[model samples]
Target chain A: MAVSVLPQMKQAPEMNPVERLMAATAADMARVNDLILDRARSHVDMVPELARYLIDSGGKRLRPMLTVAAAILFGRGQGHAVNFAAAVEFMHNATLLHDDVVDESDMRRGKPAARMVWGNKASILVGDFLLGQAFMMMVETGDIEALGVLSAASAVMAEGEVFQLAKTGDLETSAADYAEVIRAKTAVLFEAACAVGAMSGGADAAGRKALALYGLELGNAFQLVDDALDYGGQSGTLGKNVGDDLREGKMTLPVILALEAASDSERAIIASALGKPDATDLEVHQVVAIFNRYDTLRRTLDKARDHAKAAIAALDSLPDSEMKTILADVVQHSVSRAS
Target chain B: MAVSVLPQMKQAPEMNPVERLMAATAADMARVNDLILDRARSHVDMVPELARYLIDSGGKRLRPMLTVAAAILFGRGQGHAVNFAAAVEFMHNATLLHDDVVDESDMRRGKPAARMVWGNKASILVGDFLLGQAFMMMVETGDIEALGVLSAASAVMAEGEVFQLAKTGDLETSAADYAEVIRAKTAVLFEAACAVGAMSGGADAAGRKALALYGLELGNAFQLVDDALDYGGQSGTLGKNVGDDLREGKMTLPVILALEAASDSERAIIASALGKPDATDLEVHQVVAIFNRYDTLRRTLDKARDHAKAAIAALDSLPDSEMKTILADVVQHSVSRAS
Candidate 1:
C-alpha cells in the first residue's frame, strides 16, 4: 500500500500555529533562557572550563524553545515556562553528552564531541551535572505538575535509550517497537515540553491536550523521517551521512521492514551484518540497496507524512492562533527539510 | 613521622553499629525500595533487568545502607529515607557503569565490567537509566531540602569526574586539588546522604551539620586510605590490587607526594611510565618500589590516619546516642580497612 506525502505548507509562514505561538512570546522566551543560563553558572563552576566549552558550542535550544512556544500557544506567557524550558534543554544536553561518550562518537554539530576533546569521563560526568541541574531547576519552579511531567519524561528517555541498546542489532524489531522507542526516547519530551508550557500558562483541558498531541505527532514525524533519511542520501537536508543508522547497527524502520521482505540470501546477509558491533560501509551500502529494492525508504517517508498530517490535525482542535500556525510550519519542516 | 592507624572498634555482636543500623532500617528500606521500583515498572521496564544485572553484580550497596543508617541515627525513621537511600545507591551505580565505559575498564568488584558483559552502549544507557530512577525516587520523597541536597551533590560528583580526568597523569596536581576532587566525587554524596537522612528524620540544623561533617570526613578518610592501600601493598587488608592507581595512570596521594620529592631522574622515569597506560604488572611493581624508596606510601598512610581522626572529631559535637556512637565507629573503620 502506498502512502501519500502531506503537501508542503505553502502559506506556512502565515498559517503555521507554532510560528504564531512563538512570535507572540519570543521575547519572554529569550528572557527565560537568560535566567536559566545565569542560574546554570552556579553548579557549572565546578568545571568552569569544560562547562564553558560545551555551553559555548551553541545548541539549537529546541526543547526549551518548544516548551516556551507551547506555553505561548496555550495563552500562558510567563517566566515559569521559560525556566522549565531551560531545564528541559539541560536534560537534553546532559543526554547528548552522555550519548556521545557511550557511542564513542567523535563529532557533534561539526565540532569535536565533549568526550573526544575532554575525554569520556569529563563528558559522562558533565552530562550527569546537567541532569542534576535540570532537577534542581525544576524543583525551584515549585510546580508539582511540571516536576512530575519532566521527571517522568526523563525516566522514559533513559529507559528508551536502554531499550534501543538492547534491540539495536536485532532485525526482528517491528514497527510498533520502533514507534514505542521513538515515543520513549524522543516524543515524550516533546509531549512534556508542551504539557508543561500549557500548565504554566494555565490552559484549559482542551488546550493542554491539543498541545501535547501536536508535540508528540511533530516529534514522531521528525524522528520517522530521520530514520528514513539514513537509508537514502539526505546529507544536504539532514547534515549527516546516508546509511549512518545501518553503520551503527540501528534497526530503524526502513531496515526493519526491508529485512522482513528480503529474500533468503538478503536476509542472511543482513543477519550477519547486524550481528557485528561495527558493520562496514560496504555492508551499509548493501543494506541500503535492499531498502531501495523493497521501496522501504519510500514507505518510511509515507509514515512520516502521516505523522505530520496527524500533528496538523491535532492543532485543528485548538483555538485558531498565530502560535498554532508556526506549529503547522514545524510539522511541515519535520518531513520536508534536509537537516 | 609514621601515621598511627585508628584502632578498629572491637565490639561484641551486640555492639556492632553498622550491623545494628543496618538491622534497624532493613525491612522498611527494602519495602520502600519496592515502592520506588514499582513506580518504575511502566516508565522503565528495562530497569528491573539492568538493576538486577548491577545489584546482583556484588556491589556492597554501601551508600544506600549508610543513608538508611543516617536516617535512623537522626531519629527521622518514619518517612522515605529508604527510598532516598535507594536513590543514592542508584546514582552511585550509574557512576560506576559510566566510569567503566569511560575508563574502558574490564573488571569491577572482581568481576567483568558492565560494558564487558553488555557492551559500551548498554552500560552507558543503563547507567543513565539508573540515574533517572534515582531522580524518580527523589521525586517520590517530596522534600525540597532533600531534593536540593541530592541534586547539588549529584552535580558535584559529575564535576569531580571531569576535574579528575583533567588532572589525570599531570604531575603538578596538589593535595588541595586532590582533596577537592574526592570531596566532589565521593564525599559530597556521603555528606548529602547524611543530610538527606537528617532531613527525613526532622533533625535540627545542628544535628544535620554534625552528621554531614561526619559523613564528609568519613568519605575523605575512606578515599585517602583507598589511595594509600593502592601503594602500601598490604593486600590482606586492602583486598584490591596494590598500585592499581599507578597502573591506571591515576594520580593519587602517594604519587603526588612522590613526584614532589623525587630526584630529577626519578621524576622523569615516573612521568615516562605514566605516559604508557598499557604498562605491564612488572612496570607497576617498579613504580611501587620507587614509592617505597621515597617513603611516599608511608607518608600517604599517615595522612589518611589524620583524616580518619578528623572524621571522628566531626561527630564529637553530636548528641550522645547509640547511632551517633556507631557512626563514629564507622569513621574509624574508614581508615582501618584494607580495601
Candidate 2:
C-alpha cells in the first residue's frame, strides 16, 4: 500500500534487462503523471475521480509516453504531444473500464477494478465518457489526419472488444484467432499513438509507417508476454495469478499454441480444467504442471522476443535520438514485464 | 400489428399541422427503412445468431427520420443523407441496447430486449460496437464541422448517461435537473444532426444557427411529450402502460414538476406510491388522478408547444422550399405521435 517515488536514473539489477526498462518506464511514466495526467484530472473533479482512480492505480503509461517519445524522436517534442499523450492514455483507461465490466473482473493493478468500486453501469458509462473526451481532446489538434488515425483506431479497439467477447470461452479458438484479437484490442492504439505522433510532428510517410510498424510489433510482443504471464508467471511478480486466463476461459495465444502442441492426455487435462464450473486450484496447478513440462512458457517468451526484435528492426529508419533509444528500450521492457 | 404504407400526398386523418409539414418525413422515413435500416441489419448476418437476435426485435426509427427531415430542410437534400441519417439511427440503437442493460428492461418494441436475448455482457459490447460504427459512418461524411458537432453531441450524451447513473433512483430530483438530463440524454444529438445538415449544405451561420435552434426545441418538445405519455398514454396507442416511468422511479420531468406543485396530502400520497417496494395499480391510479387534477399533463404539453414554436422560429432563416416545409411539419407531427 506504500507508494514509493524513485528517481529516474535508478540502477539496473544484474541479469535482468527488465530492471533497467522498468526504471526507464518509471521515469517516463512519472513525467506524464506529473505534467499532464495530474493536471487534466484536477481540472474536472467529480468524473476525474474514476479517471485518476484507473490511471494512477499503477498502470505503466507506456502508450502515452511512447507518443511523447515518438514526438521527441521526430524532432517536435513540444506542444500537443502531451495532450495527445494524455488522449492515448485516456483511451487505454476507457477500454479498461469496459473490459472489466465485460470480464467481470474484481481487481486490476492490485486495486479493486472500476466496476468493483462504482458498479458495472457506472464503469461502462464512465468508460464511454472517457472515450468521448479523448476524441474531443484529439480534435483540438486541428489536424484531420491525426483525427482520422485516432478515430479509426478507436473503432478498431471497440471491434476488438466485441471480437474478444465473441471468441472468449470458446475451445475452438486458435493462436491465429488470439493474435487477431490482441492486435485489435491492444496493439492498434499503440500503433496509432506512435503513428499520430510521427505524422503530427511532420514525419514523412515512410517514417510514420516505420514508427507504426515498430509500435504494432512492440505492442503485440507486450501482449504476448502478458498472455504468457497469465499462464505461468509468479503471482507476486506478475500482479496476477498463474492460470488466471484458464479460469476465465480465455484462449490467449500461449494457451492456444500450447494446446496445439500438447499430448492427448495433456489436452484432456487442460480441457477439463477449462470446463470447471469454478476451476479448483489443484486443477489449475495440474494444468500448469502440464504446461511446464511442455516448456510452453519458454516457447511463448521466445515468440515474444522475436516480436520485440521485429519492433526494433522497424525503428531502424529513425535518426538516432534519446527517444528512439527509449522506444527500443520500451519494446524490450514490454516483453519482460512480469505483470 | 399490421403496418400500412402511406403515400406522402395522402395524409392520415389524425395528422396535425406539424404532421402535414412532416409529410416528406414519412417518405424519408420509409426511404431510411429501406436503404439503411434494412441493409444495416442484413449485414449483421455476419454474426448470424447474435445479429438475428438483436435486429429481428423491432425498433422505432424516430431519430434517423428526424435527421433525414432536418437534413433535407437544411439543404442537404442529396448525397448520402441516408447514410448520415442511418448513422444517427445507429447511435439511437446503440443507446437503446446499453439502456436495456442499465435499466435491466426485459422488453422493447413489444419483444425481448437485446440483453434479454443475448445477455447483458453481449448487449453492452454490441452497443459499444454500434456506437463505434456510428462514429465511422459519421467520419465518412468528410465534413469536419459535421464530425465536430456530432462528436461533441455524442460526448454530451455519454455524460448524460453517466449523470443518470449518478442520480438513479434518487427521489430528490427537480424539474431543472430533469431538463438537464433530457438535454444531454436526447436533445444534443438532435441539435447536432440539424446543425450538421445545415453546415453540410453550406448554410450561412444564421441558417445553421436556426437549424440548431429548431432541433433543440423539437427535441425538447418530443422528450417532454414522451415523458407525459409514459405517465398515462394508453397501451393500445403508445404500446406502453401508464405509470411505467413512476414504477421505474425515472424521476422524469412531469413527475418532478408535479411533485413540486403537489399539496401536502398529495405529496404524502405520491411519496408513499414512489416509496413502496411494489406500487399497486390502485396506487398508480391515485397518483394519476392527482396529476390530472393538478393539470400536470396540460402544463407539460404547453411547454412542449413552446418548444415546438421555438423550433419553427429557428427555421425562419432558411430558404422556403418543400423540404423546409416538410421539416417544419416534422416538428408538429413529432409532438403529436400516438405511438
Candidate 3:
C-alpha cells in the first residue's frame, strides 16, 4: 500500500532585530505607551488634538524601546523605566514637531504634518506643551540624576539644531562640524535615554556608562543611515520625499562629501539645488547623479557601519543575555536599512 | 543782619512699588542676572546672541524679582532662588519669543523683535534653547519639588496660550473663559515663581500656599491691566502699539466686554477690524470709540483693581515685612499702569 504523502514542513521566517526586540520588550512597551498617552492629554482641545495627531502617527517608538530593552538587560523589573521611557518619547516628538516647522516639512510619518493640518502657531504651541509635559513627567519620577541627564541632553539637542541651521547650504561645512551636529542633536538624547534607563534599572556606574556608549554609537549610525537613505532609499520607505535634505539646504554628509569631490561645474549644479525651496526634481536628480558618481552615499553608509560596529562593541563587557543580543542586532538592522 | 535764605529741602521722589521691590532684591537679583547671562551662553553663537538680545533688552525682570523677593521674605537668604529666578526669566523670554512669532509683531521692547532680526526660525529655535536651559538650571538645583511646580506651571501656561489661540476673534468668548485664559497663560507662572521661591526659602506649607495665592491674584490683576493698556495706554509706555490686541483678534477683557454690550451695527464695526492684519488707524479708533461708549476699558480696570485688592488680602496672614509691603504695593503699581 502506498503511504500517505506527508505535507511538506514549512519554515517560519526569522524576525528582524527590531521586531525581536519589540517582542521581547512588548510588556514594558505597553506600559510606556500608556504613560505617554496619559501624559499627552490636556484640558485644551487643541493641545491634545494636535498632540494626539503626532503621537498616534506611526513611529517605531525605537528610542523608548531601547530604554526598555536596556532596563531588561540589567534584570531590573520596570520601575521608573516606564516614566523615563515616556518622557524620552515626548522629548523626541517635541523635537520632531519643532523640526518639521523649522524645516517647513510637508509630510511626517507618511502623513501630512500636524502643521499642515493645524497652523504653524498651533504646531509651535503644542510642541511647547509636549516639552513641558515631558519635564513634568521626569519631575514626577523624583530622579534628580536622570532629570539632569535628560535636561542637559535637551539643551544640547537645541544647540545642535541651531548650529545645523547656521551651517545650512554652506559648502564650507566640514566633516567635523557634521559630527558635532549629529552628536549634539541626535546622539546625546540616545545616550541619555539608555543611561537613564540603566540608572532606573539599578545598573551600576560601569553598566550605565556602557549602555550610554552603546546608545551614542547607535544614534550616530542611525543618523548617518538616515542621511544616506535620504538620497539612496525610496520615498515610500522614508515617509518623506527623496532629496528633501538637499532641497532644505541641509548639509548632510552625502552632500558634503559630494561637494568635496565634484568638479566646479558639478559643484554648481549641486549648489543650485541646495537650499532652493523651489528646486525642481530634475535639479535634485542631477545632484544625486553627482553623489552617485563620487560614491558619497556608499561612503556615508560605510561610515554608518563603522558606528554600528562600535555600538555593538560597547556591549561586549556585559554578560550574555537575550536583551543584550537583541540590542546589538538592532544596531546592525538600523545600519542595514540603507541597503 | 539779613536772614540767610535757606534752600528748601527737596523731598526725595517716592520709589514706585516695583522700584522698591527691585531695590530690596538688588543683591539677589544681581546673582540672578549673572546666572541668567551665564546660562544663556552657548557654543552656538546665534543662541547667545538672540538670548542676550532678549535678556538685555530691559524687561523689568518682574517675575524673577518676585522669586527673589519671595525667598527673602521668608528669610531664606538666597540658596536656590538665584537659579530659580534665572530660570523664571528664561521661561518668560522663551514665551515672549514664541508669542511674537504667533502674533507676528514687528516690535518688542520698542525695538525690532529678535524674530525680525533673526527670522521666525531662529526665534523658535533660540526660544527652545532658552527653555531647555531653563529646565537645566532647575535640574541643577536638585529641588524636585520646585522643579515640579515650575514644570506644571509651564504646561499650564502652554495650555493657556493654546486656549487663547482657539478663542482668537471668537466674539462668543465669555468673561469666565477670559479669566481662565489669563490665569493659565499669565498667572500660573507668577504663582509658580512665588511658590517655588517660598519652597526654596524654607517656607512651610501654609506660607507657601499664601505666597502662591498672592501670586495668582497679582498675576490676574497684572494681565487684566495689560489687556486694558493695549487700548487705553500709550504705545511708548506699553512697548507695543495700541489696538494690537484688537488687530490680532485677541479676546482680551475690553474686547470681550465691548462685544457683549454692542448693538449689531456697533458689533459690525468692531468685527470689521477684528483679526484684520491691515486694519487701519481709523478702524481701530472706531472700535475704541465703541469701547469708550460702553465704558469697557474702565470696567476692565475696575476688575483689575478688585484682583489687586484680593492679592494684597492673600498676604494678610504673613508677618509684616518690607518685602511683603513691597510685594503688596507692586500689585497696585501693576494695576495702575492702565490708568
Candidate 4:
C-alpha cells in the first residue's frame, strides 16, 4: 500500500501543565537529575547499571518536579531543594523497583522491569541500595526535620503497600479502603515531597501546610486517574497492559464500585476474572462490560475530578505565581488523561 | 526407649562472654527491646505479624548488645543508646528478611523463614517497614552524625550483597573477594553500630574510632566462623543445615580455600554441588571430604581467630573497664563457635 502525503501548515506545540512546570523548574530539575545519577554510582557495577536504567527510563519525574516547584513557590531554598528533589525521586524509584517484584510485574515505564533484566534478587538489592542512598542524601542535608518527614512517609508508604496486599482480590474492599490505600501508598509521598520542599525553601507553617494539602490532593487525583486508565484507556497510553489491575486481582475503585452495583450473576462474571492471573482478554472485557454497565469508570474519574479541584483550591491561600497556575493546571491535566 | 535420670549436684552456672555482655547491658537492652516492638507495631496485621515472628525468633541480639556495650564503655549516653540499639537491630532484621528472599531461604534462626510463613511479598514489605522505622528512630534522637554512620553503612551493606550475588557460584572467587564481601555485608554494620553508640555516649574521636575498629574486626571474625561452621558444624549447632553455604553457592572463605587446594577431580566434585539447590547429602559429604583433605575448615577458623585477636587488640588503647573486658572476651567466643 502506498501512503499519500498532504501539505500542512506549521504551528507551535502547546505545552501541557506538566510540560510548563518542567520548563519552569528546568534548572533545579537538571540539578536533581545530576544529583540522582551521581549518588546512584556504586563500585558494584550492577547497582549503578540497574539504577541508571530505571532512572533514565521515561518517568515524568513529577514528584521531584513538585518538590522543586514547591520550593520555588516559597522562593528561599539555598540549594537544598536540589538534594531534597533528588532524594524524593530516588525514594519513588526504590518503591517502583520493589513494587515490580512484589507484583511480579514485567513492564515499567514502557520497558522491561529491572527484575526482568537483572533478576528478582538484583531488583530487591538495588531497590535497597537506592533507598539507602535516598536516606544518605537526606542526612547530608543535615536537615533533621526534613529527614523525619521523609522517614515517616517511608514507613507509612510501606504500611500502605502491606495493607493493599492484604486487601487484594477481596470483593468486599470498599471505596474507603481504596482511599486509605491510595493515601498511604501514593499520596503520603507526594505530601512529604512538597512539605519538605516548602520547608527547604523556608516556608512558614501555613505555606508548608498549604503545599502539603495541595500535594496530597494532587496525588489522590493522580492515582485515581491511573486506576481508571487501567480499564478506560488504551495500553499504549498507559504503558502497561489494559486490565492489568484486574488480572493482578487488585480491587481498584472501578471494580469496587462495580461489585457494589452488580447483579449476582454479573458479580460472578467479574469474580471469575478478579484474581485470576491467567484471565483471558475476553474475561477482562466481560468484567469491563460490567464496569461499564455500572458506570464505575466515569464515577471513578468523577472522584478524581473532585480531588483535582481540591488540589487546585489548596493553592488559593498561597501567593499567585506562574508556577502556582501551572501546578493547578497539572492537577486538572492529570485527571483529564482518562477522558 | 526408656530414659534414665541421674542425680546432679548443684553448681553455679558460669556466664559466657556474650551472656556477660547481655547481663551488663540488660537495662539498656530492655528499653531497646521495647522500642523495637513498639516501632514494629503497624495497623496492617501482616506487617506486625511477620515482623514480630522474625523479631521474636531466637537469634542472639548480638548487634544491639554491641551498641549498648560500646555506649557503656564510654560511661555516657542520655537514653539515646536505647534508640540506637533498637535501630541497629531493626536494620539487621531488615537485612535478614531481604536476604532470605534474595537467597530463597527456607530456614532462619532454626525457624521457618518469614518468607515461608507470610510469603516473599509480605517479607519484602515488612523488611522495608522495619528499615523505615529504624530511620525514624534515628531521626527522633536528633543525632545527624550517628544517622549518617548508619545510613552510609546501609548503602555499603546493600552494595556488598549485590557484589556477593554477582560472585555466587564462581569457583575463581578469591580470599580477597571474600574479605571484601564480608567487610561490606557484615562488618560495616557492626562498625556503624558501635561507632554510633560511642558517639551517642559522648565518646571522643579516639574512643569512637577504637569502637568502630573493634566492631569491624569482631564482625569479620563472626562471619568467618559462621562460614567455617557451615562445613564443620552439626545442623543443630548452627541453626541451619550444614553445607548450606555450598548449596547456596556462597563464595565464603572456606569454599575459596577449598577450591584453591582442590585437584581437577576434586574441583569437579565440588563444582557439581556448588550452587545446586538440591545437592544431596552424599554430594555434600564428598565436597566436605575435599575440604577436609585441604584442612580448609581449620584454616578458615584460623583466619577467624586472627580477626578475633585483632578485635581484642583494637581495644588496647581504651581505658580498661568490665565492659571492655567482656567485649574482648565476646570476640574470642564468637570465633570459638566453630571449634
The best candidate by DockQ is 4
DockQ of 3: 0.70
How well is each residue in A125-164 modelled by candidate 3, as lDDT tens digits? 9999989999999998899999999999998999999999
lDDT of 1 by residue, B1-339 (tens): 001111222335764555655555566567655754564354445567655666666655667767776776666555778778888887888888877776667777766776787777777777777778787788876776688888888877877877777787888989888889888888898888888887787778887887788778778777887888776666545445665677667778888888888889888878877746677777777777788888887777787777778878877887666666667777766666643
DockQ of each: 0.47, 0.42, 0.70, 0.74
Tens-digit lDDT string for candidate 2 (A132-167): 777667766666677778877876777677677677
Q: For model 4, name the residue pairs that clash.
A: none
Q: How many residue pairs clash in all the candidates, one count each? A: 26, 3, 0, 0
| A161-277 per-residue lDDT for model 1 (tens digits) | 877776878778888888988988888888888889888878878878888888888888878887887666766544466666666677788888988899999998777776465
Q: What TM-score, to 2 decimals, does candidate 4 have? A: 0.96
Model 3, B174-286: lDDT tens digits are 99999999999999999999998898888999999999999999999999998998987588987898989999999998989999999999999998999998899899999
| Model 3 residue B206 CA deviation in Å | 1.1
Alpha carbon lDDT of each predicted model: 0.74, 0.72, 0.89, 0.89
Write down the worst ten-residue block by lDDT for model 2 chain A.
Answer: A1-10
- In candidate 4, position B178 carries an lDDT of 92
Could you give the CAPRI-style class of model 4? medium
Model 2 C-alpha lDDT per residue in residues B1-339, reported as the tens digit of each score: 012322354545585655554465666666666644443442223333554455545554556666666665555544556666766776777777777777767777777776877788777766666666666676666655666777777778877877766665566887777778788888887887777666655577887788888888888888888888877556556656677777766777666766888898998888778635378889988988888887887788888888888988877876677666667777787777633
